[model samples]
Target: MDLRDERELEVTRRKLHVLEARYEASRREPDENAHVHELSLRSLKRMINQLKEEIARFELQTLRK
Candidate 1:
């Protein structure tokens, strides 16, 4: 891949990593804040899923070039 493609891939990977970390943190919430934690966790999960889809599309586009 070219330099631009490599840079884009790296940025996407970093974003995925950050989202995963946030999801992990949300998963470790205590029972005292069940309602809030649940909402936060769900939001994080959705973001992670979207990011995964984005990565897949990016990879497919790169392969087509």
Candidate 2:
């Protein structure tokens, strides 16, 4: 993978970490934490998208080199 692709992946990984922290912070035993959970879910989706884009870019880069 190219450097840019790896950088983007790293950013997404950091975001995932932040999301996980937020998710844990919002966790309340015997109570619903919809908002934080939702944020975490959305972050997961964003992470997935980032990963897909990185994969696509890596594939194209491979084709070039």
Candidate 3:
């Protein structure tokens, strides 16, 4: 991969890591507002899924190149 592609991959990975950490922490915490907490977790999960899909697409494109 070129420098730019490598940098983009690294940045995406870092974001994934941060989001995963946040998801785990949120899961472990006890929030008074259960509905809001559930919504927040769901949002984080959707973002994580999107990021994972982005990473997978990037890897597949790189492999095909």
Q: Rate the local accuracy (lDDT) of all candidates.
A: 0.78, 0.62, 0.88
Q: By summed lDDT, which 10 consecutive residues of candidate 1 come out lowest? A: 1-10
TM-score of each: 0.77, 0.50, 0.91
Poorest stretch of ten by lDDT in candidate 3:
1-10
lDDT of 1 by residue, 5-45 (tens): 66777887798799899788768757687898888888888
Better of 1 and 3 by TM-score: 3
Clashes of each: 0, 0, 0
Clashing pairs in 3: none
**Candidate with more favorable, higher TM-score: 1 or 2:** 1
Can you write out model 3's per-residue Cα lDDT over 1-65, one digit (the tens) per residue?
22238678889889989999999999999999999999999999999988888888888888989
What TM-score number comes out for model 2? 0.50
List runs of model 3 lying over 4 Å from the truth.
Answer: 1-4
Q: Which candidate is the best by lDDT?
A: 3
Write the residue-wise lDDT of candidate 2 on 6-51 in tens digits. Answer: 6665675676567556555645433477777776666766665665
- Name the regions of candidate 1 deviating beyond 4 angstroms: 1-4
Model 2 lDDT on a 0 to 1 scale: 0.62
Q: Identify the candidate with maximal TM-score.
A: 3
